[model samples]
Target chain A: MRIAAQAVLYAAFVAVIGYFSTSPAYVHLAPGEAVVKLSLSHAGERKEPCRTRSEAELAKLAPNMRSPTVCTRERVPVRIVVAIDGTTIFDVVAQPTGLAKDGASTVYRRLTVAAGRHRIRAELADAPGGRMTYSATTEVDLAPGRLLVIDFAPEAGGFVFRS
Target chain B: MRAALAASLDACEAAFDRAFGQAGNPWRHLGSLAFLLVVVTTATGIVVYAVYDTSVGGAYRSVRAMSAGPPAGLALARSVHRYASDALVLTMIAHLAREWLRGHAAGFRWFSWLSGVPLVALVYASGIGGYWLPFDRLAQLSLTATTEWLDALPLFGEPLARNFVSPASVPDRLLSLLVFLHIGIPLALLAFIGVHLLRLTRPRSFPPATIAAATCAALVVLALMHPARALAEADFGSEPMTVAFDWPYLFIHALQYRTSPQLLWAAAGAAGLVLAVLPWIERTPHAPAACVDLANCNGCGRCFADCPYAAITLVARSDGRHLPRQAEVDPRRCASCGICAGACPSSTPFRSGSDLATGIDLPQAPIRALRASLDRALETLAPRPAIVVFGCASGVEVASVREPGTAPIELVCIAMLPPSFVEYALRAGADGVMVSGCREGDCAYRLGHEILRARLEGSREPRLRARVSRARVRTFWGARADARSLSAAVAAFRRDLAASPRAAGPSMPPKRREALDA
Candidate 1:
């Protein structure tokens, strides 16, 4: 009788482990939903503008080591605002990477919405008063479970949408 | 409140003891059962890793291929590995709770208790690392959430999350490093396990055969029925959209997202701090440690062999005796349980005129005091068939079992009562002798009842003399909550002894008394 009880307990425990191992599927996304992950790294304009050095100041340096201009490696903190339709979903004043602060400012944020056509407007302000130095406004039709990304092209000086 | 809690735990243990019998009880052997689960995990893990691919692209491919067939076909090893790892977490937490609830983490046990604090995190880390190796959608969720969570701490200069921010950012070598972590963390787990068991003497590596077999069979059945499989492969641009999640290890990520990362960190930190400081908070006051007497010690080495904490060592003889070595007790490791006193061959009460000191003895509960207690207890019993009851203070409370014509002598632990005392009780006025301790496998000092039983059964040294009447001796066991059962057992033994006529008087066996005097 004891052996039977032990065996029944073993079976019950096994059933629990078996059912819960992979059941009640997790919903990472709702039906008819798509993801727009805004991922880009872009350094803002220099905090202080470069100026040409006078010969008198250059003379203080070693002869072979003199440069034409002096510019700070530190980049200005950039205020970014990304909107989907009319709703502002992401806003941050991103600091540049690295100790010298010359590295690119970056952001990776995901916005999940119902799959369809929608307006995505991303704006970055390098100067004061939220003035837009780089910006893009585009309409995209996304399939369910598809991922769309808004990235920055430094050379193009604007956001590039990819699906 | 604490007494109520301990009684509830004992009642639950008593229920299990009825079903499984004492030796095979799961609640009593939780530590060993957990260790056994660890072994099963490691064994099945080796089988799964044999076919696992470490590259990011190939990892999902390899796992999916393995999951293609019936459970017994190709997924056997993988399913078993996953289930065993999950079971390891369950057993480890149960072991921790059992020790903590029983107040087994104070005084001489502080070292073991303190060392085990970090093990909870280590076990989780090991399981989390296992989840990442599959490179499926669930693995991506685990890997990304973990990296982001760790980035909250200042140790890593670059955000670990940056590696998973985009498809181009995640390098193939990232999977390789994760595989390395999988190996390194479990090795650390093994090292910490060794440290955890260091203070214990002859620590049990596994549960008894019945439990081990039953647990293994259950894991196999679960694996065969469920047949663990990977979700769709991990991709950086898009996240997993409705995965079949393994909640055991992956629940951390769900929680990390539900409550903010800062809250989770605070909770985990608070829990760890409490566990680490609990031993000091409940520091039990120490009894005087056992001290060895070289004059009485014959270098027989029995006490050294019987010290449950490995506290006693055989040293070169310091006295004039011709014996090569004497027993020495390391006070720090000694728990003052007095089992060593019982293990001493010279612990015979017949040498009443002498100091009554044994080779090794607890200063708190010395042999001389015990002999005196026995003499006084028998005196209280009348001229009828008197009964002497020896009980462990940590086990059944003998005071509740005490009745007229019955003498109850409580010891620091059950094994502290020398087997010679049982024979001495029967010969010196008691019609029969009864001994009780913590229910089998639940010894407070871990080996008290086992060593005592061995001694009486003649399998161990300082055995009860063969001339001693076996019928006049009886042994019973119970938790402190089992006083009613203990009383019942004692009454039964009393009746059995009364049925067989035996005259009881305050008289000693003349021949044995003469032999000891000479």
Candidate 2:
């Protein structure tokens, strides 16, 4: 009889834990909408003026430290602006990678957007004059639960869209 | 201060044992239960992993879909997985505390204790990794706090905390890494558990069926009642306010709110070092391991089968003998409880001969010497109805049981007494025998008291004979500090023997004694 009671109690305990663990009150959420992924990689060539060292200046420096020509190695930061339906959604100054800040600047992002027909505009500038070094305007039809990718190809000289 | 702390912990353990130490109780199998819980957690975790989404954007949504719109059992699986993980930590802590309180954490037992320290850290790491699988508010909070902690170290070139600055900064590949760690840490933990039990000849890897069942049932009930669910979707741009925490595995994160991360790491590291070196800190003297006498061995393999530590093995005898096998003792694994000697049939005190030796015996205190001691103890007794008190060296000091007509005998462990020795004592004119050892769930030699109890109750082999009077034998269990209580128990047993009607003559019939002597 004592064993039977323990069995009953054990069964009840198991039942209680099982009931609570899978209690069917969890909220059901909708599936995520379409996403727009952007990938950009650009590096502007250094345009700083170079000067040749005079023999007198070279003689004043340490023998190992002498250089014939010197120019600024600082890279121009890539400025990008992304717009959807005439409204700017992304604006950033992407700096180059590496310790000397003279490498290519890269950008990767995924943005969620509602399914619809939309006009997309993107611009990038590599110099300090604020002139658009690269720009594109395109029409896109997005479907629910789909992905739209926008990428940059320097050889193509502009942005490319793939679905 | 350390001595006081150890005493306080011992007192607490004694109180806990008093409350829960019943025969066939689950509390007695905490280590086994912890292993069982780990198995349950792994099984349920596999089921959850089958449907889990690895991508950061889909991880949270996939969990929701699996929980609410599943093949129905996945929701239950997730809940069971979480609860079992929590239960595993709980049982592991209880098992560690029980071992510590029983004073079994040092000396020769240090290998098992030290191996267990890493197992705890691995369990915590694996459990926290599970939380990071679903990219929700809780995961973000865990990741933020963890990276912040790691940032305190000089090992990383860039602070890992920078990855959580925005959703754009974190990538889906990082979620994959979390999944890998979640799976990898447990595999490492399983390996450590194997190493921990390597020294023991026969480790109890799983608890008894009833205990395993009851523990599973309780976990299932908890899972069903309070199913684990992801909170709001993680927004790396926003601060996580009012994050819910699972205290068992995440209590350390709470310290982040009050103290510097470096200080928390220092405290945790110091605590871990203390636990790892505890065995060395408390160096109690242990009896040398038992040795096997090949000449006296009959090649029966009784000691090999009965050795609790699995330290004995039946090997083919190199020397020619009628019987094929002989027992070999492994010194590294032997606990030196002399249980193997007790199990040897040649250990019977009835075998009369000077310079007696058993097939397997302790080098420090051999069975022949034990017999001589028992004989001397019996000789010192006053008269018939005189009591023989058998006590363990690890338990209540037998010297404190100063009853008028009782003779006290100490053994490495009370289980070292062969059952026939009790009958021999009775036949030698003692009225009754009382045995005592470390309290239940507190045996210094792990299963010593349990094995003794089984032998006395006539359930296990080498059991006390049916011919022996049940009323003439009593067993009392208590710790070394419970010497006064043991004395009272011995006095009460003497009174009970005095009140009972005395046997007419010798305990064994004359005809039976004559046949046995032949």
What shift in Å separates residue B420 of candidate 1 from its native position after superposition?
1.8
Q: Global lDDT of each model?
A: 0.82, 0.77
Candidate number 1, chain A TM-score:
0.89
Model 1 spans > 4 angstroms off: A32-75, A97-116, A125-132, A142-148, A153-160, B1-6, B165-168, B294-300, B313-332, B502-518
DockQ of each: 0.48, 0.06
True contacts kept of each: 0.56, 0.05
Candidates' TM-scores? 0.90, 0.71
RMSD of each: 3.3, 10.0
Interface RMSD of 2: 9.9
Q: Model 2: residues >4 Å from true position, as ranges?
A: A1-163, B1-21, B24-27, B66-76, B151-162, B256-265, B315-323, B457-461, B481-504, B507-518
